[model samples]
Target: MRQSEAIACLREKGYKQATLVLLFAAIDQLAWVAGDKETVGNEGFKAWVQQYMVEKNPELLSGATAADLWGARCGVLHTGVAESNDFRKGYARRILYASNYGQVGSNDPTVLTLSLEWLGSAFAAAIVWFLSDLEADPEKDTRAREKLSRMLVDQQP
Candidate 1:
């Protein structure tokens, strides 16, 4: 449901920031569920993105590291900025978005340009990949299920 909403926002003309927020939030939530933890700190978020998102969609996220995405996530969620402390401190590159995937370029070496559409698609693919992984691994599936059961959901009347 969250993935769908993110994609919907992505397809809209002027919802780039909202799309990013939802996409990043989905990553955080999935990371927590995948780890079977009630909470996931920065390290955990980075690790999960590295394993599940970056590694899974390298071409779409070329030149972007888990740390870069993590920094973006923090910046966007915390202050509605694109550059985080990590980017300012030389820890991660600042990210800019384009219209589609494979359209990456930036004059500044410390900055990266990616396609927001590609990002949304890649993230959706990552979720599918993660689900397949859980299906193949019973232990992981059980753990994720346990965590998911604890997640709050709107009750249908």
Candidate 2:
């Protein structure tokens, strides 16, 4: 699916904890696929996590950041509790809808479908983080952009 559509779905959902879980799962899957990893297991995920670090210009793993987000997602999914009363609904529906019907590669529909889901989730999470930055008083939005740029640079072997 187009990135815009994915973001729209996430926006429509508003912001919910469960959606956050799905979003992270999707991102984990994307990192696996992007890194050409075959499995999504713990070991595999560790390697997948490394992809994020390797992509960083300074080569530091944002383990603390990832762990905090992960812990929050787990709490939400397990407790059925939202830290905020304002639980954003319809996010999964939007993700599912866009993922199911997204227009993508002509080569392999199955792979494309998976990729679409992953990309949609990952991109959606990114948008949420970006928006949070505005609220968090982020001085800059260079981290993600810089890491991505470095990934591209390193990949050009």
Candidate 3:
């Protein structure tokens, strides 16, 4: 549901920042579905991302990209901002540069910029790969299935 909503929000005007936040939350949900209770934090997300990208497609979600996503997630989730260093202890925080993810193609190659479309595509690809992995070996991937089952049960009446 959240993944679908996030994708949908992408097409809406002035909702890119909100959509990016949803996207990162969806990524965490994927980790939870994969039974990653321990490494679901900032660093853990990157570690799993590194492995997932290497195992599936390194061109899509590289380590540097994951790192930038983590930083952005930290900034948004913790400080209500996109840059990690732009937050301060005050009555209100600034919401500058809502576009957390920019265009990877046009971004400077020397600088690591987190692009919304690229990460979304990479995340979608990762999800497809994970589903294929489950179909290939249910036993090996039972952790994710079990976790998903738990989530479903928890959400039940």
Best candidate (score: lDDT): 1
Per-prediction RMSD in angstroms? 2.0, 16.4, 6.3
Which segments of model 3 are wrong by more than 4 Å? Answer: 36-39, 53-63, 85-111, 152-157
Clashing pairs in 1: none
Candidate 2 weakest ten by summed lDDT: 89-98
User: Residue by residue across 1-157, what tens digits does model 3's lDDT show?
Assistant: 4455446667366676677677667777776665446457655676656556435665544335555556666677666665564223321222223234444432443334444555666777777876776789877478777776656322323
Error of 1 at 55 (Å): 1.4
What shift in Å separates residue 126 of candidate 1 from its native position after superposition? 0.6
> Against the correct fold, how does model 1 do in TM-score?
0.89
Off by over 4 Å in 2: 1-4, 35-37, 53-63, 69-157
Candidate 3: which pairs clash? none
Better of 2 and 3 by lDDT: 3
TM-score of each: 0.89, 0.34, 0.66
lDDT of 3 at 60: 45
lDDT, model 1: 0.82
**Pairs with steric clashes in candidate 2:** 13-91, 15-88
Residues 1-157 of candidate 2 have per-residue lDDT tens digits of 2334444566457543334555555555544444433445444444433334223311121112333233333444455442312123211111111234334333422111123344344445444544454346433334334333543222222
How many clashes in each structure?
A: 0, 2, 0
Q: Evaluate model 2: give its lDDT.
A: 0.37
